[model samples]
Target: MREILVRNTDLSEATPILAVTEASLAEVLAGLGQSAGNWCAVNDFSGRPSSCLLIPSAEGSGATVLFGVEETGLPHPFALGAIVGSLPKGDYSLADGFPDPEQAALGFALSAYRFEQYVTPSRKIRRLGVGKDVDLDRIGIVLDGVKLARDLINTPANDLGPEELAAAVAALFEKHGGAGRVVVGEDLLDENFPMVHAVGRASSRAPRIADFTWGEASNPKVTLVGKGVIFDTGGLNLKPGSSMSLMKKDMGGSANVLGLASMIMAAKLPVRLRVIVPCVENAVSGNAFRPGDILSSRKGLSVEIGNTDAEGRLILGDALALADEESPDLMIDMATLTGAARVALGPDLPPYYTHDEGLAEDIAVMAEAAADPLWRLPLWQPYMKYLDSKVADINHINTSGAGFAGSITAALFLSRFVENTESWIHFDIFGWTPADKPGKPAGGEAQGIRCLFDLISERYSSAQ
Candidate 1:
């Protein structure tokens, strides 16, 4: 973790100076009993991306900072990142009040994340300070979990295979005193997790289902399942080179579920929590399952592989079946599942599916409040026929029928595996920000995580 957090004190003499726009700077200078004319003049101050101005103080100890943001407001999360990354290594506090202190602080923490495992950093440590009102302890916990998720997704498959991914989750489980187990390799075949095994057997790393449980046994159960394709080669159908470049992030769903689970356990929510991740790597080999091949799922459903690239749902099918067997009060599954979903909605907006209107409404509301945006797409039972298979019970990918609504069809496939659970939702997420934006970086991200955290907090915290 980078030293992104800057701690501020209340002492008047030790207050760090901030240089805003000429107009705003005049008022702040006057309040401090200092002349605005003494400050260095910054001529071009357009509120744009990565804009900054440094005005020297009389003592020349260090320059005060003036960051330009869009006239509309701070670009949020991303803008704060650019600011922190550009600043020198030191603790500098804002002389004036920030419009949204919480968001600004959160953005600073997020920008400090770095995945530096292979090589050590040569650059000196950079530290930052926040305003007195910001809650550093709480922000550290949240950002640590979020960074853990991004690091897991950002790591390459060779270093972070199915077993390694399970180990990451187990660390969180142990940290929270939760129970966790990993059922590996051939055990998947013996335990009736055929879909999970079929999708991963081509790879040397092997596939497994990682299960974790926490909280009291008698409490209302909330189960989360994530599609943990550590690396996706698109199997026999094969993805184009351009499409395969970022496939290491296919396990982003598992990373996100573990992130949210960390939040739930850290807060000590009353509900019993269960996290199921079917970790795998869909690789191409002679023995790899090909298009038109049929595989029986643990849920007793036979699925035909219309496109071998559509393997996320195959592993998720087995995990969902296992989660559904427990019949938790609520079950949610997240996956970086389909390209069609990315076409319908872009990378930033995660599309979710749910049959329960009330649960959907709650998720949407909480998502907005947490600033983790999500859009709800209908299950649209009419699209279910698109996945109908002539030889097998169902098709993994729709070939021709209802050419549209691919995301809905994929969600519908996983929906079959989940029975007895009245409240079930599936999230099709990009898990990567293509470009830098307020708060979100250009690399791996945890979409809908904060929203899920807020939803769990509201329901479970209130019950306790």
Candidate 2:
């Protein structure tokens, strides 16, 4: 939350970011005079969509940025994204040529993010001067939330274990003047978070649940449940080294939940917001929960552990059941749970599951508007047969094994725990950027939360 997006600036002194399309390119070069035209030709700057040309200022040192916009995707929101990381360290302002400046500014702030804790980054501070059309307050708040999630997800498990994850939730609630606490260690079993305790029992780090609430009690209720597996060693059924490399990001769901909560509370949205995070580390030890162990849930459902690696759902099941007890107006759970979700929609577009058609349509519309990507996969009750267990009420993982619609089955498993909530959405997010993209860098990412935030804001805007 360091003030990265600068609001006020000496407009005359700032470097101008002149956005151009092929249609506008000629007029721009002509307006700059023959000398500027010569510069463009000599430099081979044709103003293609991805191409950027920097023209040295005749009166001063730093250059004016000439950015190309794709004509096909008119008003591409993130067109200014590349400038964040590419532009030289200085004050920059977007010229009036671009449409959707609000979204463009938001994209710029998001693209500006860097996880620089472990090592000093080479780049210096670069600030954007977004004029009156953009809401700097909203941009700053959303960016802070997104930054929190990315930072938490980027941090390794060695520094951010189960205890640390709980602490982070406590810190968020504290910042927003909300009251909350965590139940940790053997106390979790007594508190009825048996599955949570079972998952983290093997690790030295204690398993726990973090619950916090904000806003007026009488307002519309929105409860968020996030899967907080601080690190996944996959318990007894360990993952190969390649798969284990990103286990630190398993808590991304919790990270995103806290991030979204931060935005809601900071904006002072008129809704009762309750966040529940089941924090655990699925580690290997003599005492780890084994396959075929029928673990009891907070909802009174019995879950037969099909694989120790499918530990995220176990933790989420307890949390979802706990959240559903009150039957909040909306209940949403986020998890970096399934590789199948990544396979189905790739890394960028996370798949969401919702039984309610109206809610699904609203989410889809808002996701598009917010520029936060999501694809809907059915709750498909017919596929619920895949989860049946002879020994227990349900099996935690699909008995059909991998590629048997693993993401769908995982959502189906979570759905069984949630009986009371009519409006519940499940987000199976990968939560990592495999490579660098414009607004998203190569590391931990914040997914689905922004779209959900917009949806919530609209639903409860008039409420107190």
Candidate 3:
């Protein structure tokens, strides 16, 4: 992770980063003297939001960075991210009048993130010196979780298959002194995770379900399930070349859950955390589960494969069922499950579904506060009919009603396996940032985990 520190350093020794708004730009420029003020005027620096300008110091060894932020509306958590790559490699401090200096420090650290597994990074991100008000430890923990998720999602399937994904979870648990168990291959069948086994039967690597436990078991149980399809070839229903290109990110949901787990453990929240990841690769082969085949799930509900591309929900169905058996105080399953969700909310905003109105409201408020965007899409019980299967208990994908409300239908399908939990919510996330934005670059992104972590922390922390 990039360095974000709360250091007491003299202003003269470090470059200053001034956060300017449209109304404050003139006053800030006037403070810099006539030469710098004239330079700002000559450059036509009007303090447009997300814009950055660099002014050479009198010594010519360091520089003063001007970052533009909006005067009103929601706080831009990543406003300072624009300067991460543009600034020279040196220590920098936020000048007075900067809004939300803590978030700016986080933005700088996040923007420095680069997936350097296969290739080395060409340049280093400049470090930031934050004030005493900034919680450096909290920022470091959050950045560590976000970077962990990004690194997992960004890795290619060749190196990060089902076994490797399980290993990642085990390593995390080991790091935190938690216990974890992974059941793989025929053990999935032996353990009655038929849906997980069936969906992953065709892959060269074996399928697995990793269960990680942490915190006191007596505390409020918060269980998280993630869809870990390492690669989706669309099975017998092959996707087009364009659609299959980024299939390596199919396991983004599991990556996100692990990331959230990291945050919870780091914060030492007062809750028993259980994470279930159904790892698989929906590949096409002779043994690949085909359409019209009926598979019995861990919940005892029979599922008929409607479309092989919709295999994410099938694996999650078993995982959710297993989690439901424990009757946790709160249960959440996140997946890069549907193109329909992406179409409805786009890549930046992920849509979540839940029957609980109170939980939905809390999530909405926390999402805005945490700057992790989420939209609540209704469960719409009426859409459950679309998943009807004449031969089996349910169809994995809804084939009725011209495919309208696809994301809602997908959530309903998973909801069938989760009957015991009242606080069950499902997140259908895109998990990929198609374009570069202020704190988030165009790569694997952790969509809703931060908000979820905030919600979990608040809910359980108050009980203590």
Candidate 4:
């Protein structure tokens, strides 16, 4: 992981060096004289993603750093990734003022992350020798949580079924000393998680509800529910081949929730944490639930299955209902629920829905601070009637045929089950990156985890 901290001293113990753009390379080096070493003259040549050089102590008293960007503005995230890995293992401090240390820290930490769970020979990484000001330990903790999420989402569906997902949750509980419970198979029917069972009945892996409790019970309660559809074959209402290609990441919501939970537990926040994952695999079997089927939910609401492909909302409804029963101080749910959300806001930004205006504003603040961007989408009350059904209490799919505001409708469906909660927020995330970016590669990404972690930290820190 990367370490970043505010430096207070101007250390004169190091070599003198100079960093210059291609246009000013000669003039900068000539003016600095022999006190700067031959290698001290680093270039800011365009086209370099992140490149740097280390000048020897012979001709210099202090090192000069040059960044390779077209404009003289805030440095890009991960700009120091390649340099951090290659710098000699020695104590080094930032010489100049940095406007954004968090972004720089994230870049360094994420660069060290490698998914080697199944590797024959584990990869080795060197410790980043940073100055005392840098809190590298905190950076490592955050990266570890992110890597956990990515590894879970990237695993094949065969190896990561509902049972396996539950087991993973159990591992977290055992590691953090939290209490975990899993209700599977017929137990779902007995416990009145009928909708969870119905949607999962088509698959060989039984549907289950994985719950975990942590922190002081007397503290303010926070409930997090994530849709853990391991693989979505679209059940009876199937998806096209391209859509099925990325269905393995349908469980990204679960991975993200677990990641955020890990951060809270590791940081020892002063809030009671409860994570509820409705784990299932939406597959097609002889017993698959079809369109027009009416399934009873944990909240006693009967939902008409207008479309089986819209199964994420069905399972989440039951989990949210159970979360609402606790009447937690705050309730948050995340899912890769709709393509329309991505089409409207692009893959880089996820749309979030919340009833509490202040809570949403706070989340936006934290999102900006953490650099894990998110956007707000309306939970329009006008569209509530779109989900109305004649035979059942509500329709699972919108009947308007044109499918307007897909993300809002999904959030509206979830809203029905969370009436009593003081604050409720829902996130529709892409979960997977189509291409690579600094720190975040083109694979399973931990969306919304950092922002939520920041929010929790701020809230509990204030209480302390």
lDDT of each: 0.81, 0.87, 0.88, 0.79
Candidate 1 lDDT tens digits, 83-126: 66666655566556554566666776676666677789647444
C-alpha RMSD by candidate, in order: 2.7, 1.6, 1.6, 4.2
User: In candidate 2, which residue pairs get closer than 3 Å at backbone N, Cα or C atoms, i.e. clash?
Assistant: none
Off by over 4 Å in 3: 6-12, 73-75
- List model 2 lDDT by residue over 1-464, tens digit each: 33555654544567777878878888998887787788789989888886787787676566677888777543456667766776778778877756677777777777778889999885677777777787888877888889999999999999999889999999889888998889989999898989998998999888899999998899889999999999998889999999999999999999998889989998899999999999998989999999989999898999999899999999998899889889999999999999989888999999999989999999999999998999999988888888989999899887865448899999999998899999999999998999987778889999998988888888889553
Give me candidate 1's TM-score against the actual structure: 0.92
Candidate 3's clash total is 0
TM-score of each: 0.92, 0.97, 0.97, 0.87
**Runs of candidate 4 exceeding 4 Å displacement:** 1-65, 69-73, 82-99, 119-127
For residues 105-220, write the lDDT of model 3, one tens digit per residue.
Answer: 87778777888888977565466787887888888888889999999999999999999999999999888888989999999989999999998999999999999999898999
Candidate 4 displacement at residue 275 in angstroms:
0.7
Candidate with the greatest lDDT versus the true structure: 3
Better of 2 and 3 by lDDT: 3
